[model samples]
Target: MVTVNEAKQLIIANTQLLEKQKCALDEALGRVLAEDVIAPISLPPFRQSSMDGYAIIHTDITQKGTPLTISGESKAGQADLPELKPGSTIRIFTGAPVPVGATAVVMQENTARENGTLTINEYPIPDGKNIRRVGQQIREGAVALGAGSLVSPGAIGFLKGMNMNEVIVHRKPKIGLLVTGDELLKAGDALVPGKIYESNSAMLAAALTNAGASEIEVKYAADDFAATAEALAALIRDNDVVLASGGISVGDYDFVGTALESLGAETIFYKVRQKPGKPLLFGKKDGKLIFALPGNPASSLVCYYEYVLPALRRMTGWSDPFLRALQLPVRYGYSFDGERDEFLKAKIEGSEVVQLDGQESFVIGSFAVADALIYLPVHQNKIEAGELVEVHLLPV
Candidate 1:
């Protein structure tokens, strides 16, 4: 068995980045940019009015209460703008282009206009007031967003404002999920003695989707050696990454390890020194990655978060793919002396983290309400109340 850090390092060292693809802005949310996006043109494109006011040369407002003739009106989106004659102003609305000779704008609220004449009630209007110069937000040919940046909703709007229809981003991974167990039955099926409803498939699928995976195919296989091998082979052949839930432990019916060996898969690491998911296995065949998780639902989910999720993010060209970590105080005292590191389901209450009940590998009730995982190293046995502990915040 490998240490948790060693396991994580091996997975990352073995993972390779996927190919880049051009993605339309409409469908690029949550994708990592493969290249920097440059602004094609300056934002605003021209000097623009930031308020509904009058555009005039600063010298025209010689003193307080100075009156100037309102030469013409300039509404937003107007292509033809009236020239501002000497000692005169133009009634301009927000986002309208400033006239050629105008150097300042006084908001309408600070001025009074009637009968084609405008008076400034406030004195000494600052030069270039309420005017957004060309390239105020971004200049042409400047980098809008650097590579490795995650495209967010706001980024989409920003890129659209830059007149970009598509962006170059790393392609999402295609995953093949295989669930193995003879005693497992699908939901809504009548369960016989010693049989239970299988839920790991649906649970892991949702988790994968949350991590930005879109192309996922699921398969079921019985515990028999041949059937398991056949199903595993097919999954490896069809997908870039394969995830097998169950049949990796030392039990008599476990066949995932043997199947992988027979198929010439290289075992990068077999197990990790961690609670809830000690039987996790990682390997590679050809250029495809594979992960075999423990049969218990909670163990499988924990392994996915700690190991598989990071690998997927790395493959998609993310620079920082690990879970968000923080040091938080514990709400209550807890004690445990185990041979391996423990990850307990927890929820943050105000400034402290509270460990939830039912943390067994087979129980997932507490995990349902958990928003973080409190990490407990192998050497530590007890935590007093109000003590600091490392916590990893879940993506949700």
Candidate 2:
């Protein structure tokens, strides 16, 4: 067995980042940028009106309630607009390019139009009122997004406005999922006396997808050694990472360790000094990562968030891979005699952390409402209420 920190270090040290790929803006959300996105042109491309008003030279309006002839109209999306005639105003709409020689846009609310004539009810105060100057948002050929940035909705909109159709981003990893157990039954299947519904793959898949992985192939393996070994070898060859749940402990059907050895994979560690997932196993073969996780659903999830998740982020070139950790006071005291570090499913209730009632690995009721994981060290057993503890915030 290894300490939690040592296992985490080993897992991250062996991860290899995937290559970059060009993808359309529509498909770039939530992926990491592999290259800097440079603005091809100025954001607005031209000086634009920020209001549905009239464009005129500031000097053209000498006093309040001034009237000028309406010579032309400039609507958004119109090209090659004629210049604003001297001593006259041009009707303009929001997002419309400012006509040449125009110094300010008078808000329509302050202007009245009648008989092809315009009157400024109130004098505009500023020279560039209600107008967006050229290159106001970004300069031409400027860096719109730096490399290693997480592609978000705002990023997509910004890139689109910058006329970027596609961007280079780190590719999502291809994963192979294998579950081993003879007593497992699929959902909607008839229940048997000695069988339980298979849920680890579904939960793991959902978690992986939420973490930005898209190409996940799920499979099942029986308890037999031949079947388990064949499936493990196949997944290792076909995917960047292979995740197997169950068949790792000392039992008649536990074949994951033996299977990994048969496939020529070197085990970096077989267990961790942590609750819920002490039997977690990590291996590497020809640069491919293999995680043989424990059978319990909670155990698998805990291992995923603590170890496997960081590896996935590393493979995708994320600058920070770990969950958000914070120091918070607890709502109540806690006492434990275990030697392994325990992760308690908990939530933040205002100023303090409250550990959920059901902490057992097989019981997931509390996990449904958990927003954070309360980390309690093995050496320290008793912590009084309001004492500070480290909390790992889950991704919302």
Candidate 3:
């Protein structure tokens, strides 16, 4: 069995970066940029007004309530701006182009306009106030966003403002998920003998989706050697990464690991020195990556966060893909039972953390309310009330 760090390195070392693809701005959310996005034209391409008021030269407002004749009106989306003649001002709405020789916009509330006259009530309106200067937001040919940046919702609107319709980004991965077991049944199915409702498939699928894999294909195998082998082979050939939940341990029905080896995949690592998910299996073909996690729902999710998540990030060209982890003091003491390091489900409140109940691999009841996972090393038998421990924060 490999250590957790060694296991993670093995998975990352075998991952190959996927090729970049062009996508519309609407589809670019949560994707990493593959190239720099250069602005074709400056944002607010022309000097524009930011307020609905009178545009005037700053020096023209010499005293309080100084009157100036309104020359014309400039509304948003107008083709031409009426220029401000000497001793005159133009009424401009928000987002309207600022006329030539206009220095500021005195908000209508600050000015009293009757007939064609305007005045400044707000004393000493600063130069460039209420006006968005040309190229002020973004300059033409400037790097609007650098390569490797994550495209967020704000980025979409910003890119649109920069006149970009399409962008080159590391494409979201396509995943193939195989749920294996003969004793598993769907939620609505009847439970007979030792059969139980399947939950790992849903858990794994949700995790992969949260990790930004949009194209997911899920299937089930009945622990039969032929069925497991056929499903594993197809998944390996059809997806960027394959996540198989169950059948990885050394049981008579455990066929996932054997199926992977029979498919000519190079096994990177098998088990890890960790609790909850000790039967993890990682293998790779020439370029495709496969991870076979334990059958238990909680165990599968723990492995997904610790191992599968980083692999997805590496494939999609992320600089850092691991979960945000930090150390905090424990609020309760615990007795250790196993030699393997354990990732105990817990909640963090203020500066302290408390381990939750139901930490058994099959019990996911406590996991629902958990915000983080506390890491307890192998040799540490007890946790003092105020001892610091590392925590892996879950995605909110």
Using lDDT as the measure, the top candidate is: 1
lDDT tens digits by residue: candidate 2, 184-247: 9998999999999999999999999999888998889999999999999889988999999999
**Winner on TM-score (1 vs 3):** 1
Model 1 steric clash pairs: none
RMSD of each predicted structure: 1.3, 2.5, 2.4
Candidate 1: worst 10 consecutive residues by lDDT?
Answer: 374-383
TM-score to true structure, per model: 0.97, 0.90, 0.91
The CA-based lDDT of model 2 is what? 0.90
Misplaced by over 4 Å in model 3 are 327-331, 335-338, 348-354, 378-388
Instruction: Look at candidate 1 and tell me the lDDT of residue 96.
Output: 96
- Worst window of 10 by summed lDDT in candidate 3: 116-125
State the number of backbone clashes in model 2: 0
Model 2 spans with C-alpha error above 4 angstroms: 61-67, 112-124, 349-352, 379-381
Query: lDDT by residue for model 1 over 333-372, one digit each (tens)?
Result: 9888768899999999999999999999999888899999
Ranking by lDDT: 1, 2, 3
